[model samples]
Target: MAIVRFVLCLMVEILVLPVTILQYVGIWDSLYKRVFPHLMCRMTTTINDKMGKVKKELFDKLPEFASSSGLTILEVGCGSGANFQFYPWDCKVICTDPNPNFQRLLESSGAKNEHVKLEKFLVASGEDLSPVASASVDAVVCTLVLCTAENVDAVLKEILRVLKPGGAFFFIEHVAADKMTWLHFIQHVIQPAWRYFGDGCYLTRDTRASLEKANFSQLNVKNIVAPLTSLIKYQIVGYAVK
Candidate 1:
């Protein structure tokens, strides 16, 4: 079984060698950034359909939690603006992402979801949201993004920094499976390759634990298994208050 596993891993590595080489030579960024958004665009409908109800249940609360008449939300890692449709009507959104290539798709999504305003799009990572002011946003939304963060702790800190006092941080993230589970073992096995292929997404990250340690005044997290591939089926969904 060990030898079989080695051979399978070797085959997978061989299949991904070109991409690995491109990443090493710095050529992958140009291709990946452009291609990934389009791929996401294709998958957006299916994803939204599957996850829309839960997203709405969480996102709809933004208006009630807002300190102002109108809501101002800052979305970190806002790829393809997938969450745009879920925001409350007329709420302005400040979208930040490390990949600039998603801007066009984001704009397109904004156009389609006219109920929510796409206030601005900044080319920024979650770890550094400097363009946005401290305690400015009424809410921060991070969906399916923590897995890809280069620094989860730093990203959480930034989220806390930008949120107004009493502001809520809504999140939906796929987390590592329970320890000693078969899925956990598989996650460990594939994590290195998965990170490269999935754009820095760590398959085995204990995101809920990181969130707990971030010192949110209130946390209401729940785990659920979404109807997705087993690799990322285990997920956490809920909100934290600053």
Candidate 2:
């Protein structure tokens, strides 16, 4: 049995090797982008109800979330426009995503949320937001994105740079569970597979720590057990003001 297991593991490793190489060279991003919309469309359909409840919990608890009318908001990694319905009327939005394939979905969502102006759909990475002006945006929104960032620190710095002095960064992200727990152990074990299949999403990223380290003027983060699978159940939700 042990020998058989070893042989199976080696076979899996061989299959994954080419994908790892592609990811390293950035080709995997292009390939993933092409299929991401279809995959997410199905996923959103299934999880929309559950995710809606989670989003409401976060948005309701955060003050001024619905009243940020007329403010310019930047949404980093605005995947398929899942958060569009949450924005209030009269809030102008600038959305940036590395995948240009999301453009169609974004436009469709923008059309539905006619009140919120979709200022620009920049094909950009969160790590280097050169297209967005420093300290210009009133707020930044990120959800389930930091894990995939090439450099979380760089992304945080760029987010800080782009936000106005008193602007807020709203986020909801799955994070590493408490140490010594079975869930944590599983997360660590499945990280290699998860990161590859989940679009470079690391299962063990300490996103809250990164946010705190960025020295936000006010950090009101809360860890909650989301209605998701164990591997990604623990999520940090709230906003940090600059």
* Index of the highest-TM-score prediction: 1
TM-score of each: 0.93, 0.88
Task: Give Cα distance to truth, residue 91, candidate 1, Å.
Answer: 0.4
Candidate 2 segments whose C-alpha is farther than 4 A from its true place = 1-15, 22-27, 60-69
Q: What is the lDDT of residue 234 in candidate 1?
A: 95
Candidate 1 per-residue lDDT over residues 17-96, each given as its tens digit:
88888889999877888898888787767878998898899888889777656789999999998898888888999999
Name the lDDT of candidate 2.
0.82
Write the residue-wise lDDT of candidate 2 on 152-190 in tens digits.
Answer: 989999999998888889898989999868667666666
* Residue 137, candidate 2: C-alpha displacement in angstroms: 0.9
